[model samples]
Target chain A: MSRLPPLVPGFVAAGLVVGIIGASLGALFVVGSGADGSILGDPYVRRIVVFTLWQAGLSAVLAVGLAIPVARALARRRFPGRTALLHLFGLPLVLPVIVAVFGIVLVFGGHGWINQALDRLSLGPLGSLYGLQGILLAHVFFNLPLAVRALLLALATVPGESWRLAAQLGMAPAQVFRFVEWPVLRQALPGIATLVFFLCFTSFAAVLTLGGGPAATVLEVAIYQALRLDFDLGRAGSLAIAQLAICGLVAAGLLGLGRSVAVTPELGRATARPDVRRGVGALGDGLAIAIAAALVALPLAALVARGLTGPLSTVLRDPAIWSAAGRSLAVGVSAAALALAVACGLAVATRELRLTYRVRHLATAPDMVAALPLATSVLALGAGLFALLHRVVAVFDVALILVAGINALFVLPYAMRLIAPRMLHVAEAYGPLCASLGISGWNRLRLVEWPSLRAPVGLALALGAALAAGDLGAVALFGTQDTATLPLLLYQRMASYRMEEAAVIALLLMAIAGALFIVLERGIGGREHP
Target chain B: MSTLDLQAVGFRYEDMTMTFTLRVPAGGITALIGPSGAGKTTLLNLIAGFERPVSGRVLIDGVDMAGRAPADRPVTMLFQEHNLFPHLTAADNVGLGIHPGLRLAAPERARVDEALDEIGLAGLGRRLPGQLSGGERQRVALARSLVRRRPILLLDEPFAALGPGLRRDMLALVDRLRRAQGLTVLMVSHDPGDARRIAERTAFVHSGHILAEGPTADVLGPGATPEVADYLGEHV
Candidate 1:
């Protein structure tokens, strides 16, 4: 018997599992909802859709809007520890969303330090931090760094030759920006804006924690409420279908927009650092730096401080915290493995397929798939899955499946980003050779493709695992008292006002997540230098 | 026998209605020379089978290859930017030409080693493309094509980055290899001198039309049209 390639079996197995699960869940929703016509008649459903759009739109705009100046400053200025700072700005990208929400609440909530300080000044008590405003605040806090990182990366893309030409022409700073920097940023903005918009739109945990009521709820929250709170399977199904339709439409639109904006070659040369010599520019740069720093630092500082001064020792000693942490680790590892496996399949398929018009569309599938989960929140997805799976699986088993599903969906984007570029490059560079040698299937992947993808694969797994570890949403929907993950445990602690214990867990989560990312990056990245 | 033949081959971009057509014979360097936007690179892409033409036919040794994908085409392309996989060693890059699917045993590895050795990069197989100099990268790319043993080779200004001396040396090496392998070579070049140095025949492309085609010396001579002259003057 001829031995089949290992990757083929791996791909088939993973694809079948994911496809079956996704399809079965989707089918269940359709079947459970007897109304075949349209799901638009329900006022509750319409409200959820409208609410989702509003919050996502507001959050995306604010995140991207604030990111512009900060990005410009970071791009132009060369301050001390700029490299470290740039890395810090990007840190939140991999930081679990749950952790970020905790950090946000600690600093910005009504009972948070900021509100307490405002009160001390005899300012009338600020309104509750559990509504539209709070959701927007959390979105900004989480995504602002992402916006800055992406935009700064884009701003740094202006060619040094362009800068030199501007200098030779004796162009002013504003003129330099007008001619040199504007074009690059303009090219990059639409894609970045759309990315941030979609991220905010599908946000689960942020909305869950901060949303005050049905009126204030986003689509994802509404889906959770329908399933978990009301046990309304029919309503949940309709909402899921609606969420998919809306998010799918936006994703398609974004993909079209993305195609039109051709990615230009990254200019590798270094430009002259920002000259903060004058009054306004210097002050502007300073303000930008300060604002960027405070946005990230304030919440983190509050979390750390709260951990240190309050019930720190008691939280550490709690056995529930340890158990939850262990469960979180297990779930994270499984999710990462699943995501990596999916990414590998997609990458291989991309390579094996010929670049026809049809294949070009297929190539973008992973992007859309990765972004889909983000558009519909993990909580909503879990709820949808929970309602669907109730027919065949036990609730406890369903929770684990939901956790895995959410993690897989969350990590897909990172995995795609990590693996696709390298995979495409290899295929472009080496495909003809491989093809000519008749290396169509498994052996090609094993001997030729795998070695090249090793670093990217490892990084993808690390990123996927880190993301999964920090996720707090889906678990909340499906979690039993026994199945509690770290994020759930931390939330439990926070809800019970065990500030010290939550803080320690949050810190520990960050360390584990950060350490995993570092280890993978170093492991893969070290090969180049050594 | 001619290893490659393009019989009224044509290509058009997705947004465009216009189709380009060209025909080139095999077994020696045929330079496709033109100004920017004149469809020179497009011609190479079509020949390499990277882009399928809307209406035309390409043949490799009398086999119609119009609908064939790049991988299936008996043609290897050396892009201008030296698209050597950055992470792979020079020898590994060369060995890729042997294709792992061939499950090339020890003997095939020996052939790859021999090709690299022939190109004066005998012991540098362990070094990645990033570590190699531009000229060396070009050599590695050349060695990869040589190892592939494909009858047709497409050079998209592969030697455009080399220094004057290195360019001449590489051109000479390509000439010798083409003769030895009896390879059909189609190359795109902005440099008239490059065309003259390497091509047995040259085709002048302008506005997606092959304005002139014949012996390299005759096509590049003063009798050439003002547009071709202008294109050559600016580049060469």
Candidate 2:
């Protein structure tokens, strides 16, 4: 009887994740069930719940609605920096959220660039940048690029043959969109929309900083408030469960929308789109591209300009700022290492279980486990761990570790998405050769796995570091005076109306996150060495 | 080299149950020609210990190969592509045959050098697979197989990606190596001409069964069975 290769490491890693998430959820249920009344009975709680759905729904609708034209324009046109623009779209995903929000405030605030232009034109100043509109602007600023990238990936899947057929028949622009593009768009639209909506729904830092009052409060922030401000464990637990259910539904909607759209290998081949060359349509495409680019770029430009012109000397003199930066660095690096290790374990096990053992169900289990954080909100996990660990161990003592662990889970899905497929591809291609040559264990890893996995693993680590460094959710829940990282520090400055100080901190945060991203990507994920 | 025998080997792929039985002579070339998905590669995989037989023994020189791993069997195989690691230098790839770690002693290193010389890639061992031409990459893979010093060599259309002239040259190189080392070779080919060029014996595989087996000229000639004739219709 032939025995299967040991899959213990992957399963053990996956089990640890399951135990962490499952125990957290169990704690939330226990605390929530003990509450005296329905958490939704209070009008304020109901309003917060309703507003959470309202903002997320509107944000997703607006982002995805705007992304369609922008994606089409991008797909049809080719120009200089086109590839750079696509890479820029990837930035918003890993870019620090608080930094971008500062950028939004600088560009769209009452005394900012756009209002200054409006006032110069004899138009009155637009009102405050601290309400529902502020939240929507920030959400779209972050998600529009994301939606465009996703849709562009979808558009890339349109076969060169289909484009050739369309060109041969001389299909007009409208006919081409209707016949060829719309079907692909229709399939990808739901998945992108759900992703955007889920992101906005669970957003904490943007909503907290810009929420202004109870009118703009989201469940994520409300849970934070119930735990930290009100010291009401019951309300926090109830809010965590509500957020979990809604996120679970959104995740299910995403999975239900998943259909395996067949992609031919002849992707990225130079297929000139028939209806989009040197015409009025080309002019419109250029216009769409410009507007989308401006929407993404202006804020970042304003951020750097405002930050460079802020109170540089005073902010630099502050010891708290430097310390916070150090702590953020520590958390970022540790989180990245942990995230990559867990993701690799899950990916290797998933590949081996599927290909070697032929255990289909177990192969997919690690992926599901890796995706747990998407359904279980980071704030929910934070609240549960707080409830479970507060009495036994001082949560404040191990605050950095908690934040890093939770952040690893937060970014686990992206890590798995980026790493698993590449690993599987390497396995499928070289597995038989390696097996025939007795290249197992460390020999296989060093000679075979590392060479192929370096790029994706570097990407995962860089993204994980940047995202974790900029994260404000778990840190907000656990951050005491000593544990405040750069994002938390920036939030504190912004709250106290220290706009100039916030500007410098924002710039510093962006620099730190950007440096980590570049260093990890370049240092570890070096150019595919020949 | 040793004799290879498949004694009523049975495998179920999806809804199809395939049964194969063939005796490949020692130190000789046996070519498997069939329609696509007609179990040509499967037969080679069974002999290489990559797939297990459900109902019969794969006897390599009268020793049952059941439960033996692919590496434990005295076999080497080359696929159409990915025969050489794209990232490794030609010499390092060949040296993997000597030690999976590529930690070779001086004599083993000399053996790698000698194998590369035999395959006409003598001084090109430091180049990565990306730097080598398609035919040269196959030559590198052939060198690795030579250094492995395995008794059985299975080729799953290893030269299918090359042009006709390159393919002919590679076949001649294989014939030379087979003659020098006395290695038993079982090669699968879609092109009957590949078998006619150098294979001493040819087997016509049709719908999961060996329909015809004999000297290469007769099996690939007008005397073939109807299924074989249909499969080889235009080529023959």
Candidate 3:
């Protein structure tokens, strides 16, 4: 059986990505006049860039800084539901962006639950839901759980032998962290922090909704504002270029994170982590878990609580809501299918590339290809696509397709995370067998590869779908009255002070997002084989 | 008589360099006995076409198999473990030897069944590799090699994981297969007793060089090289 050379898929993936991001930025450069000093000369653009960096920086620092204690607590403690707690912390991964933002709003809004509590306690109602605080709150809300889980994984990876040694030496808790924990965390922290930073920096839908006004704008919002509201294509192009430069720099910085901490393979031979239960440490860990749990759970509770208001029948009967939900389902399914195809191709191709090239750097190439697009804000992607397609077809007419394409690209890194490692493992284990047995090409895929990859491949598709279902970035730029997705419709309803409809739609979007995730992750995908 | 030859073959992995010039007479069994990390496995890999030698020819029956893929080589190898896909049943794994597609004709299927039954795994063809005992697993692997109908077989410690009694049985099976098929066999083992049991000739590989190659009794006889004498210890 013959197959194409391994580099073909990666090159195709890289090409499509370059064509999209490159054409977006290049066309902007071509069409727009030299607005070289736009970030400095234009006061509005200057404010937006500063705020974008300021919020992402603050969010990254807070997410990681706070996650350290929470993650350590989870790692060291063997409390009941510890596993469930870690899974809960991953909720934001499947929850759509708008649903998360809605949850945040319901908790932090002026008339929301937290403000009501403050008023009852005679602490002045904190109207923190509409500006810089709102943006940072949502960012932290989304990223803190992820940061904690990542850090916990980092903490657990500190070889069991090291823990036994620390215990045998009777090292104090602080000393244990300093000598043992800190080194592992230090290795993993940069990647997690930089990832969180890039995500917040490319903030779109959440920023679009919570930005309050021009006073708290980000570069992404500015691009959308220029293109959609002002119809200033030149200004939008300049802003898109500016955003890419800043994001590209951050993405490059992210590539430097310490990686692949070799798991000391001596298993069953090493003793279990020196069973720890000191009084002071136990008390402190309990406190950390309590605080983190409350911080993560309250907003989700608020989303459900705030949504049960307004006549339930009227809320469900709204035809626009049903239509928006239908559109979202279609878009999510289509994007997931598209993203899975792309992710599988790139992963398999990368496996081939690694085999043919036999270089360590090329092994990490697929990850970089997947991640580079992540740093390119979808708003900028939207602006570029709009410019290119506006030349041939009307921008609004192809809005759904454009949004699906962007969301697919946006969800790609996550899909690759599920796919690439397992693909490489399969290639390593079976490459010789395949070579020896004359199993190659489509037959190899059908007989050998598919049986192994089905689970992770299914998981990747599900995650892709969930992310697409909840996308607000591209939808906000191109969404029209005729073709508005649930997220866009939810945002529009919130903008018009139809809080009743907004709440209902918020719950609906969350349910849909959560349902797709559960169905695909649990129902479709089988247990991952080692 | 078919011959298996390695003509000045050389391979380098990391810091270790291995060179070989060897010949195996048709139907003779050569035991490659070495300490661990002595490149015995690497030599087998080269001959099986899993890896290419840096220099010279791997000539099987007067044909230089320089550019042949592993599947194209007239050799079959059984690794120490993982010789069969865990997902495939014993029959299916054996069927892969005859046709990798595992889409055997009715007669070919009967042949696979017969091979299994001959290996004393008649009713176990439906069992996955994981379900089989260590000795049974290697029997399945050996049976697969038998179905391949290759003239030369390279077995790298195929029964190393089996117990002493089971190891003897597996070696007997190899001997039976070799005599019946007139197969030229090269088997790597750390145990000198294994060479005494089945091999006609024994080759001692130590740190990238072959220390001795002769009839097993002569090589392990009193006049053996000091290094070989020292290594074989009591097992010889």
Candidate 3 chain B lDDT trough over 10 residues, lowest sum:
B95-104
A155-180: candidate 1 lDDT, tens digit per residue: 76555434432332234567556555
lDDT of 1 by residue, B81-123 (tens): 7356554578766776676222467998898889988888998
The lDDT leader among the candidates is 2
Candidate 2 lDDT tens digits, A378-486 = 8999999988888889999899999999998988887888788889899999999998999988889899988888887887888899999999999999998899999
Name every residue pair that clashes in candidate 3: none
Chain A agreement with the truth for model 1, given as TM-score = 0.87
Cα lDDT tens digits, model 3, B125-194, are: 9998889988888899888778878888888898888888889888888888888888999999878888
Expressed as tens digits, the lDDT of each residue in B1-236 for candidate 2 is 78999899998767778899899999999999988888887787677655667888898999998976555677888777767655569998788777754668999999999999999988998999899999999899899889888888889898998899999999999999999998999999978889998999998887788888889989988777778788877554
Instruction: Give me the runs in candidate 1 sitting further than 4 Å from their true place.
Output: A5-14, A21-25, A35-39, A116-127, A258-269, A273-277, A355-377, A430-451, A524-530, B1-236
Please state the CAPRI-style docking class of candidate 3.
incorrect
Error of 2 at A322 (Å): 1.4
Ten-residue stretch with the least lDDT total in model 2 chain B? B79-88
Q: Interface RMSD (Å), each candidate?
A: 19.2, 21.9, 22.1
TM-score of predicted model 3? 0.67
Q: What TM-score does the predicted chain A of each candidate obtain versus native chain A?
A: 0.87, 0.95, 0.92
